[model samples]
Target: MKCIIVNDDSEMRKTIGKLIGHSRGMKLLSVFNSTSEAALFLRDNCVDLVFFDIQMYDVKNLEFIQNISERTFVIYIPEFSPFVNTTKKPQLEQLSESTIAKRFKKGVDEARIFLKLIKKEKPDILDDYFVI
Candidate 1:
């Protein structure tokens, strides 16, 4: 699956990018230091997944995720407990900050399952089905 990482911390970005590089069937398309940069990329590219930080300085996490294409899955890396509420959205998944390497593969597997289920249930669903 094609993917991107969005995080303000350079170290976190490197960590996640490396994890993606090592994962089977996963491709690291790009890494951005902020949500706005990722958003701009999304406008022209069609990636299958995004690893996004839930708290960023440039954009509101909820709004950014809500606006992205539904076909593009999001795995959130939340920085605070309060931001965990964003996972209430059915299509959104959260990766535990404590065990990123352990959880990354699980999150990707879950996303694949979710896309299959959604396609089975509504074959004609638009890519914009993801909304707040």
Candidate 2:
């Protein structure tokens, strides 16, 4: 899966980039320090996954999420406890900072399954795969 990281923290970006680089079937496409930069990239490019910092600027507006395509999945990285409402949005998920490595791996695994189901055109089971 092609992926990008958008975070103001350089260390966090590097960390997540490395994880993506090391993960099988995953590619690190690019990294952005701001939401506007990522938005500009997304305007023309479509990636399979995005690792977005929830505390980043413009995140509160939620315009960024609305701008992306439904096929794209997002994993929100929070500096603290995440409180975003993920209710009907199966494409969106939050990664706990305390267990980032484990959660990230799980998210990637689930995304892979989701993509496979999408490729198989199994819409019925898609809803069952994502709890929230």
Candidate with top TM-score is: 2
Which regions in candidate 1 have their CA more than 4 angstroms from the true location?
80-98, 118-132
What TM-score do all the candidates reach, one by one?
0.72, 0.75
Candidate 2's displacement at residue 99, Å, is: 4.0
Measured with C-alpha atoms, the lDDT of residue 96 in candidate 1 is: 56
lDDT of 2 by residue, 52-120 (tens): 887776643388877866677778776543344455422222544446677778878877877777778
TM-score of 2: 0.75
Tell me the tens digit of each residue's lDDT in model 1 across 22-65. 88888888999877777889999988888887777764666778
Summing lDDT over every window of 10 consecutive residues in candidate 1, give the lowest-scoring window: 86-95
Separately for all candidates shown, the number of backbone clashes (residues 3 or more apart, or on different chains) is 0, 0
Rate residue 76 of model 1 by lDDT.
81
Question: What TM value does model 1 have?
Answer: 0.72
